[model samples]
Target: MPKSLVNYRVRHAFLVSYLLIVCTAAVLGASQLQTDPGSITVRFIIFGVIALILMVVGAIMGAVSKKRSASDIGEWNYRKSLLSIREYEKVLGRHEEDFKVFYDDTSSAGGCCCTISAAYLLYLALGIIPEGGIDASFWFTPAATLFIIIGYALLGLTSYGIGQHSVTFGVGDFFVAPDYRGLKHAKMLEDEEALYVKSLVKIGTQDDLQALFETEWRVYLDGQPDTVYIQLKVDKAHIYDYPYLVGIIVNGPDVVERTENLDIDTRFPGIVEYMSDEGVSVLVSRFDIPSDSAELEHEPNITAQEFRKLAKALARRLIKLSTE
Candidate 1:
């Protein structure tokens, strides 16, 4: 719940409590002359207890408000974005200002309420809160001890759930930014934008490549009208097993004349060679990596040293595949 709403509800409770106490006091004083002293004492004790309970509840609400300070929420959202791709800006080409993200995972209903109930049971078994001790809380402080235990447990659960699944942006997710295409097609793709503003989220800094060319390279790649290029970037994600950028080329300069799954190198991965428009041949993965290096980025188009000469290597392949 929002902090504002919580505070509003607490304030309303306090206001109602005060009104009820005032009205009860006036009615009791008016009837004092007709009632016995014993009954009057009982009524006084009851109203006093009610006011005390309301005060304690108010104090709890105040502490909760402080714990969820505005700064805490802002910091939490920033840190949470890094774990997953939910914050699309790091991957998609969208105007940073226009994007908005949302998160929703409610705790199981009565989650902490149940915990408190269990604590009551345990206290009864150990004789801390007597067997008929439910109302004994008014006379003792053990009830507050149980409340403290439940509160900490609830906070821990909330933190744990947030940590486990940091993001939900999946494989095909994308954002449309004019800057992505140098603002040329921003107007063209405007109608294709999401209904709501995207949220900015935390993205990992472990590899600069992901930030440079996100998994949505497909969006950038497919957007080009005539250019086919070479891409040597890490797997489309931060959580993936592979840690290195793998070289892959698009729009071969030559159509593949034929294709055969061949082991080009015993130590290196294999290839599926095939050909199309403008001498375009789709040359991609064919061999499975050995288990030991299974996590290595699969670069079927180019070898180690050749990767450093990426542009020239791609041009050469485009030529060889085209004219041959």
Candidate 2:
């Protein structure tokens, strides 16, 4: 399924159905007025004008306000955007100005009021004083009853649509701005991945591998809050068999690094591939040292405390390497 890059939203069903109900009421009232020659009165005009004003106000509300929260993952997939921390911050900063809020998800109170008032007005307009005077036969008429029911249902639906955040813009979903940052992250990730692969391939000696490690750390340390942090994990149960420690990716181009770096040469002497000694019952038997790249920003198993510990350890290692 194609995804939306912009924040344009509309409620066409609510708008179109609302207009239809108003038109139908008008047409039916006009027919009744024509049938009863002396029934066209000032009260009828007032009701018509008021209903028109309410409809217009509803239309404006739907047009200007956003229907969903900015953080809605289904509508705005921030994770898939693969934006750097800095770029993600920019997107969040612009959210308030970009999407104006009028009614929230719990606006059902207003909807209830609207539904009640519409139903009552519909009953009065189509029943008791349809024009200026009422006919005995039309007082308990089925036509008025039908119109009231239909009008109530239509108004209820329109109000519900306005009050909730489920309505989507359908075709207008793709009408986002060309320069949306989310749309550009894929290209940026691609370029970064290329650079990462090149760096990995260039390690020929232990000194070169150390240089790559320092370079990657230096790049992240320089970027500070904007850096994309990656976490590599080893199941606690299999940690002993894995040889190398579960660690963070100090440097990688994209958010995920899938490439294998298991070549145990002079440049990566201790990087071994191990088979779990846990017999045939083990689900994952083979393990790569410095494991395949971490898939997410942080592995779920590593807690905040564990992260701080690992970070301090890495900092010590970096300092030692720098002094050497």
Locate the minimum summed-lDDT window of 10 residues in model 1: 69-78
TM values, all candidates: 0.31, 0.28
TM-score of 1: 0.31
Q: 244-287, model 1: which lDDT tens digit per residue?
A: 22223344454434644443433444444445545345443223
Candidate 1 Cα deviation (angstroms), residue 125: 8.7
Error of 1 at 249 (Å): 9.5
Which whole-number lDDT from 0 to 100 does residue 276 have in model 1? 51
How many Å off is the CA of 153 in candidate 1?
A: 10
lDDT of each: 0.33, 0.35
Clash counts for the predictions, in order:
12, 0
Candidate 2, residues 1-324, lDDT tens digits: the string is 111323333445545656666666556554554454334353344244534454445544443343432223233221123334354345433442333232123335566556656764764465436446456355334554455345434553454445344334333422232222222222232223211110111111121111100011111222223222222222333332221122222232222222223322222222212122222111111233344335324333333333333333433333332332
Quote the lDDT for 166 in model 2: 35
Error of 2 at 56 (Å): 21
